[model samples]
Target: MVQPVSTLNHPTLLESPQEWDLSTLYQGFDDPQLTGDLEQLQQTAIQFRDTFRDNIKDLTAEQIADCLKQLEAIAQQSGILYAFPALIFSADTRNTEAKQMQDKVLEALTSIENQLLFFDLELKNLDDARYAELEQSAVLQSYRHYFYNLSKFRPYKLSEAVEQTRNQDSLTGRQAFINLRSVHLGEQEYEPVSTPDGKSCSTEAELGALLFHPNAEVRYNAYGSVRSVMQQHNSLYGYILNSVAQDHKLENQMRGYDSTLHKQLLADEVSEPVFRAIMSGTRDRFDLWQRYYTLKGQALGQTIRTCDVYAPWDSQPVEPLPYKAGVETLLAAIADFDVNYARRAEEFFLKNWVDAKVRPGKRGGAFCWYIHGKHSCLLLSYTEDYNSLFTLAHEMGHGLHFAWISDRQSYFNSNPPMILAEIASTFNELLLLDYLLKQAGDNPALKKTLITRQLEDQLNLLFRQSTISRLELAMHDRATQGTFDHTFVNDQWMSLYHELCGDAVEVLPDHQYDWARIGHIYFKPYYCYQYTASNIVSLACYQKYLQVGKDFIPGYLELLSAGGSMDQVTALKQYVDVDLEDPATISAALKYVEGLLDQLQATL
Candidate 1:
């Protein structure tokens, strides 16, 4: 067995890059506690169903309060059980033990989740008067968002048999195609970097990093290798995409949802108009993306390709920052915002809450995962670039949000939705960017570099993400209309490219397969819009922070603490001034991106 990444000795957790300590989650897959917890969870679920499934609608307010407690207890246990193995597997997919443990967890979870499915459906079926009566009780006030959101599906509830069958098919159905895509993309290695000791082929993320490489030849070779590999498998990837898209379409149709995007908006607790407004607002700012790309090409003193868009301006060799230095940088910046936010962030490192090392088999990209009513875990592959530091801040931002709010809210409402979740992470990124800019001071050279990168983040977080969402909308719409195959998918994907970048940058032929490259469409359709939504709102939040300084911290903290206890739009209205429903909110966000572009241009 691959030994667990050795736990750290120094408090820094970075003298050597630390892997997360999962002992708190479980001792091992074979730890009898794994089985014991599963059994206990299963028992609780069965007991819950047996006691409440038939009588949920009739439970008095006090009884309903108790019912929620039992359900929350059951859910909290199951959440931990599901998260551990799933996380372990991502760290090392090659581990047979990890794989088998994850499968076991999935099997147990499916069974438990199946048993508990009756709770929500039956709860939703309660008469309006009953649900209102339960919600109005002072005892139930804390859970108001939980039950109200639960009852949201009253209009769309399917028969128990249909829902159960759908859950059963989930593993083998669209999920299988998603898994296939994951394995296929993860396994393919690209040509090595020109640096000494570089291997003959690189991991997918290593290839992605090359897009930022200063050596133009190395970047182009890596870019070509990526393109060639993607093209080689593009057809099969296309097949997988079509299969999953078809599966999603079939599910949406069966459920009577208005559209595919509509389904996701509902889950995010956002309305369709809000989603489209963010999307359209971003679309109207494609010129900002074009300006950034054109300016980047000028800085590079060469024609810009899709690959070169992320290339940093200065060609000087950037010495990799020590991981500890990166942490200090982020912590100091966060401290400038709010001491508690910084303190909460420091705990991730001091307590060994992060797995920030890069190794073969660990997942690509960075993510923050929640541990029910406890703290959180952050996983990332840290390089020494400013981008790496930004990623560190980005995830710790999430860790801090989850870490703090775990105490503020109950199990039922503690887990925030995507709409609000992105705000914390993206907001932290803004904090980091602001910190970097201030540190640059009057040094134009440093200022130019940091500003360019900051703008690049906006392009990435705001514009590129929304473009992907637009492509998703078209692809899903076509799927609903009739036949959709790989070719039609490719054409639509490329069409969005032409529209998004115009004549500013080359789209290249193989970029058509980008839809397949995105795992989100497979896992959570139309989810990309949230990044745009969150980034724009985050810009608004940052602007407010600038205006009110420390006064803004309380509201921002309140925003995070509210978690998923309220629908996202309502949460924003209650805590912050931004409104997702207003096109003007998005318009203001675009102006922020435009301002960044203008700064970059002024530097040029």
Candidate 2:
């Protein structure tokens, strides 16, 4: 059974690498050279603000470019300082010192932000002819991508006074309420759930474990415990939802965003039609998922409920895999896609790029962070399960992608949008699945089960997340219209969820409150659709690579390295020719899933 979230800090947690060998960034955060560089940048920022904030219009293109370069350097240093321990804290929320370090760096960053608030404002003021000339200027040419991004936001840019007002208000506005929600939501207590052996389990941990449990009762009881806790706190969650929705309403209207979906689409550099295509195509695949669940319920001899959705195909407990074998297996699987991808992942593992151990006060979940100009840091809880192996491969994919980009782009242009961020990781998962399936060769039952599980993975990443995105959009729209309250959110959530699960599994009444526990809803509204988008793209690309053999691997590498320097859709097209707006792409994925379900039924 999964342990309590708090147990992440147990003394038995893995020891993190002390150095993590980040010579690629700076020798150390406190190294004399880096310290000297940081101090110089800080002073330069001060000088630039003092010298040019009031008279930047008269500056030459060379002067503006030189100042921007200095600002980029300073921002890079701050990001490097923030990445390591921030990652450590994410791996274990209980780490007091790491948390403190994050706070200190955040405060320092705010100071730096205030110092350079005038840079963009002043740069935008240049006359059209001068701006065009600057675009071709030798110094400014290096920053073409950055300059283009700024130009895109020109229409959305407010007057300097109004911009400053919104910037300050941001701290106490919708963002603040979201942060406030995290504190209370993260600490909410669910009742202890009982494992198959009748041992008490942590609510958070139990839910995770139950999802993979072979025993139907275990999954049911665990889910019951989770729902009980959520229902108990329903009223409190309602108030937070109302407050945040009202805040979004006020701000979205003030900012002139056409609709709730428009904000996310704009941020993702895509359009509503693209997102709608994904959602609609995936939603239409619910019958395939339902058929699979029907077979699953029949195999288990139980009435399939929400909890039963995660029961393992085999009733036997999976033996724990050794760490080295797990790592080797994943690397080999990824190698099938591109040898260099596997090698890069191996380098990170060997170089202590991963913080895999669970520790006290460490946070739950997994992530990969590209620490400025230095190196990537990965944080995850490794239990040696198949799930953990997939997670390791996923995050390693993120690291390898970032490594490629860091080798290619300047600090200012290396960031990819969150919508496209999952593509690399999910791509790794598909490769791993291919590897595992190949090894399972003649073991029919095992092969079938593996395929079934992969189908479940697709369902969650695509179909289920689409449900979340729709719910988020509905909530945001209603809230913006000042019509959303607790009841409204609960009802909308249930309706959307039912559409995904179909008639095969029963969702308990209390399950409607499940949205309250989803932190992503609080962090980035309508962001969950990215999982669906990325999975569809990953599958489409993996299919092409498999078809074309080694020739396509080079193109795949180019896509990874291109990063944000190119538009996400363009990079995706460079590797795979599918258009996201074409419903056929997602329909192809669903058809594949339906074929798997048919195979399972035929075997039965």
Candidate 3:
């Protein structure tokens, strides 16, 4: 459902280069500096291991702080070394040199990590009393959360030798399967479909854009073509998926995790009870999802099929918003909210940190990759529509979040957990929504489009993502027991799809192959639920901002600046007065969705 809106035909916009400049990291794969950095990173790792391999338990608080600072420097070096080739590979998956460099970097980094694994392992092995004393010392005050988070994994720590073995094996074990999925998808050729503009799509991203086309036949054919490719290769994708799941299953057991979900929640710094609450809360509100789609069906004067979910509400062709116009509008929205945020966001454009050009061999979807102690880079294929505009705002929100973290926190504390990662991005989207709605003014058609778009986003984020999470749980359960084939996954996906859609939307046959297309399931397990949880939290935070007005900016900024220095639950409660543990918090967000549905219904 996340696709570009329309193709930009403006000469001025088209003339501007939309690629990101990576000279800030390195000039090229063959750059001499890239090799120098790798050599230095390996040396640093050796020095770190030789200095602190078995001495962590005996070190004083000040000595521990010094050790951490050294590790932080090493991490920054390794980040640059890995990020360079990885970014190049992302820009063009088919680039053989880039892919080779990526693999080489990964092998080297894995060895480096293996050398440095003893520091955390020994730290986690420290006695509880001594650990508490060092954690509370003034010398280690800045790293108190770092120590606390490390200790949470104490029960999951394996022997240093075993840990090192796993790190080395992942090159050909778990990580290899993940890479296979990426390369396979990148090489896939979807059958081209006809569009109203006589446009044809060769890549999955281009085909995805057609799903939002005004013509129903175009949407249907695009959907069918995408699934047909997945169906043709379902066996390979299924094997990759099973391999990843089996790896997770074995590792979970080895780490003493009660369930695969437990291990994922631990990494997110979220409690199992809180995760269950979010899932239950989302599942309880299936009616809202059904009601919205039912109304969409009425508006279209036809039963909403699976492919019609993203169909345009208006049959008239939409004027493409030029890329420059989209940028200006996004900046204006941030400026209207706060001038400081707008100023920081402008740097992404000014510094050439964004790659928005659409081209073959480039990966599908958008992501913002942040290098600690440096800036973030965004990648997206821009087609000059409202969806692309919102995607721009979302990824920039991530860039701004990382900007604050890089400015305020150490590298050790800069990476926020996945659960909190989506907060700023989703918050930015809501702000843009409000700005565009107000700008619509007396234009009822524009207002309806904006409103319906927001509703669709909420549906995708809340209901659809939660359903994916459910499928993940089921998949992991089967993996824990024995094994499951593509057919098992297909049936489970359809079952969950039917549960979510109920009698409102028609569940198509091609929808069964849809599970193969979700890259996250094969890449990061349990990542989908974070989208659901973050959406709920973002809605609550946005509502609070409306109530508090200007008073809310400082605490919100502080939340972003805090990064991983504090647990997300405490950060949310302290900064925005939103409690994730409370059922009422979930109810409030669902109420807001209902209010939006009511507004759209009134328009109908």
Q: Best candidate, TM-score-wise?
A: 3
lDDT of 3 at 511: 96
**Per-residue lDDT over 69-100 for candidate 2, one digit per residue giving the tens place of the 0 to 100 score:** 77778788778766755664565455566556
- Superposed by TM-score, candidate 3 places the C-alpha of residue 521 at a distance from the truth, in angstroms, of 1.1
**Residues forming the 10-long window of minimal summed lDDT in candidate 1:** 1-10
Count of clashing residue pairs in every prediction: 0, 12, 0
lDDT of 3 at 384: 69
Q: Give the winner by lDDT: 2 or 3.
A: 3
RMSD of each: 4.0, 5.1, 3.1
Look at candidate 1 and give me any clashing residue pairs. Answer: none
Runs in model 1 lying further than 4 Å from the true structure = 1-11, 196-201
- Whole-model alpha-carbon lDDT for candidate 3: 0.87
Off by over 4 Å in 3: 1-17
Flag the better candidate by TM-score, 1 or 3.
3
lDDT of each: 0.78, 0.71, 0.87
Give one digit per residue, the lDDT tens place, for model 3 in 1-604.
1122212222333334388888999999889999998998999889888988898888998899999999899889888888888887888888888889999999999999999999999888888899899889999999988988898899999999999999998999999999988887777777888776777786777788787788999989999998998899888888889989999989998999988898888888988888899889999999999999899898899999999998889998567777777877788788778888887888788777888887777888899999986789999888767888889999999999999888899988998988678999999999999888877778788788888889999989989998999999999999989988899999999999999999899999999999998988988889999998898989988999999998999999999999999888999999888898888888888898899999888878
lDDT digits (tens) for residues 1-604 of candidate 1: 0011112223555665678888888888778998998998888888888887788777777888888888788878888988888788777666667767766777778888888888788878778987778778898988998877777767888877788888878778887777667666666666655643364436656666667777777767777776787778878887887788788889888988888777777788887777767776777778888888887787778777776777768886455666776777787788877776777787788888889877777777888889886678899877656777888888888888887688698788888888789888888888877777776566666677677788888888788888888878888888888757778878888888888888788887767766666778777888888888888888888888888888888888889999888877888877877777778778888888788787777757
